[model samples]
Target: MKIKKKKRTSLLYQTNVEYGDWCLNHIENCAHGCKYPCYAMMMAKRFGRIKSYDEWINPILVENSLEILDKEIPKYKDKINFVHLCFTTDPFMYKYPEVVELTLKIIKKLNENDIKITALTKGVLPEILKNFSPENEYGVTLVSLTEHFKTNYEPYAAPFEERLKSLKHLHEAGFRTWVSIEPYPTPNIDPENKIDALLDIVSFADKIVFGRMNYNPEINNFKDARRFFEECSQKVIKFCEQNNKEHHIKFGTRYFDNKNTQTLFNKK
Candidate 1:
């Protein structure tokens, strides 16, 4: 489907997502088409931000985002630490070159107005990123290293190896970098089914967040659910502590592992 473009009344706002206090999405739909199958998409569907699966895949760019932010941002500049580039959409979502260009323009405009930038994407970081201040925080969501899992889950998102390379490059170039290991999938109950993608890139992750696969029956109903998450959390916490990298366990992970599954997605 051809991508849809639209203009909006406003383009910046506050967010409850842990990474940032405020956020701005320059697009209406995400092209990633993740299969967690993306809680963001699920919420968007519920709120009527997107009407259907097909529409969500088609991406709607906020054509006047830069103009809207000019009016909205100055009013909240002092109150905002950094506006995350997106929560509902990937700033670097692959498959659509125009989305990447729009993302770069949005970031440049926000930075020109002295707004800090922070973003986590399933898309690869292009060379254009070097033009921005190294102070901007960058991140990638990596659940596993296997192509099989990614193919079955986050299919349209950047491949795991590509995400790893992106984070590594950012860290090497002196940019503050982080990784999101949330919705860390467990396709089957066996330990062999579990992955150790973290060990592959922990060295460069300036910050890390480990989380359980919330709302997935395959993992939630596993007999070793508690053991798996506990082990993973411990590993992440240990590495973060040893390397002096900032880290957090997503709020409901410990609770879910301890059999408190009800609170998993209860947070806003």
Candidate 2:
């Protein structure tokens, strides 16, 4: 619940995560405290940005983020396909009004320049987001639907139903919407329901991004890990096709049994 501010050199930069998209992490740490070996927290430590998990759970807002964007947006506005709100931190982090204020400003700034924006969050999507350009895309990270799984893994994120409801509202409002089921847990961690059951809930999404968990040793112990993910990935593809939706199976989620690696996104 502690807030701190720090300065950064630039607010926007191209990320190579999937297909070279511009991204910005306006905050240093996340308050969600996700325990699925949070990759952001891990990277923060590896880079000596934070000393411990406790520190990582306390977010540090990027100082003058708006001013930096005001200057940087013009330089890259011509080349940017769309600026992703955040990959390392939540823009609408719960119980943090300042974070939300900054996020609104950033969205407005980019929209004023006719730049597109894409945002993914575990926190509640503010109702005002509907005021933004309809071209902007919004998404939520929803790997599980059970509160038991949420309590154990995502300690501080908004409840699963709340996130879904929020996203559904956005979708209903004619805003482009998506869901990221990235780092989805194997049965050992979730053991609740099949992937289809979960996907059924977010079927309204315009797109779905699915990926298997990584950087976790426990997953490696699951002997059926490879098979489980392959079957799950296939299910996602099938569901997306049947429902006439766009979906992306992240790199490495499916082991190409035929060793033919195609691009991740398959629009139906």
**Strongest candidate by lDDT:** 2
Clash count in backbone of candidate 1: 0
> How far off is model 2, as Cα RMSD?
2.6
Error of 2 at 39 (Å): 0.8
- The residue ranges of model 2 lying beyond 4 angstroms of the native Cα positions read 257-268
Q: What TM-score does candidate 1 reach?
A: 0.89
**What lDDT would candidate 2 get against the real structure?**
0.86
Pairs of colliding residues, candidate 1: none
lDDT of the candidates, in the order given? 0.76, 0.86
Per-residue lDDT of model 2, residues 86-133, tens digit only: 888889897788888889899999888988788899999999999998
Candidate 1 lDDT by residue in tens digits, 1-268: 3567888898788876666577888887788887777787888999987788777877888888878887987788888777787888899987788888888888888788777788789989876687796668888888776667777777789887788787788888888878888877655722333445455455677888778787666775677777777778888878888889877778666634443222212112
lDDT of 1 at 97: 85
Cα error, candidate 2, residue 266 (Å):
13
